[model samples]
Target: MNTTHRTIVSRRARPAKEPLSQEVIVKQAFLLLREEGISGLTMRKVAKTLDTGASSLYVYVKDLQELSSYVLDYALASVKLPDSDSEEWKNNLFAALISYQQVLYKDPGVAELALTTMPLGPHSLALSEYLLKQLAASGMQAASAAWGLDLLLMHVTSSAFEHVSWAKNEKRSFTLMKEAYLSADASQFPFIHSHKNELFSGDASNNERFLWGMEVILQGILKQDQ
Candidate 1:
């Protein structure tokens, strides 16, 4: 007769699980967002990742929405900001926003969160404060600064989303659209036919186009203040 023997590991010998806390829960959720994207981030998944019951997560987070806000804010912690007293305030502002865009560009889930969730956390507040201060230094009125901040953030978020979407195998759709635009009937769409090359001039991989758009928006805001 053949017999099988196995060693049983004692629970006491196992490593202790990390203590549950709001920060831990949020970090786990952020991990899920990076690994499995926005769709995979949930209380149940975060609880599973932490080796705990989903109900336990409720003690730390109110709901998925609240947790998403926390996760978004957590991800924003990596964004680099320039010195407050930098002489090149405009360039500094642009650099800060570009840093923010690069952060979102790294993960499609983050871009989605930036567009859909308004994170009311310290990191989010810091980014907003930094941008507002930069805008103020440029002689922007309070109203313009506030509204321009929204527009600037929206542009970066949307641009990141579009770039990520294209990178994630959506290029076929873009290609087909470009072909359709380029092949438009000259008699029907004269302008599109004439400017087809310029229409698709800059691809998403180029930062020059993004910077140009930023310049246009900044110029508009500055002019509005005048």
Candidate 2:
């Protein structure tokens, strides 16, 4: 029986999956940002999600800021620039701004990153160059176009962050917070109580409010050129 028995040997276990590339690491970071707020995102957490060690991440991203820069650049890439010959510059610009807001809204924590960082990567530079070109084509002087693009980008980032804050707090649900705001003494704050309807008229109407602001800015820019 001993001579008839043959042992079957199994091959060595497959090697573990290769560590993520820098781009994959950064992409996962953005996913974590969207899943958990910015405060929840950490190098350790990112590594855990990627099934790798934190040391593996440092090979690509130097620090949190660099990771953030990557995420912002990726997010900004979603903003599509209009064709060079497209005549509706204002409309195209407006579309780009709206698209930016949509991207931020889809990933609220991204707004936080976008607010603190300046776009410096190829993706960012491309967007900036495209915007500047669009503005210049619309008859804006080079300096005005450059500065205007800066102002508009700043405004979008700030506004998106504010919206993200509101979304995070659930302040849009006027049912709970609205009552507190309305309960304030009418005599001391007549204006506050009087405007409660307008202040919290509809819950979760950020899209409309954002569009209104965008229109106002677009109008101002158009008027300046006219």
lDDT of 1 by residue, 1-226 (tens): 7578879999999999999999999988888899988888988889998999999999978899999999999999999999886467798899899999999999889998998998969999999999999998887799999999999999999999988888887999999999999999999999999999999887656697898899999999999889
Could you tell me every candidate's TM-score relative to the true structure? Answer: 0.94, 0.76
RMSD of each: 1.8, 4.2
Top-lDDT structure, candidate number = 1
The residue-level lDDT of candidate 1 at 34 comes to 92
**60-139: candidate 2 lDDT, tens digit per residue:** 88887888888789778787766665487777777777777777777888888888876547788887777777777788
The lDDT per prediction is 0.91, 0.77
Clashing residue pairs, candidate 1? none
lDDT of 2: 0.77
- Give the 10-residue window scoring lowest on summed lDDT in candidate 2: 200-209
Best by TM-score: 1
The TM-score, computed over Cα atoms with residue i paired to residue i, of candidate 1 is 0.94
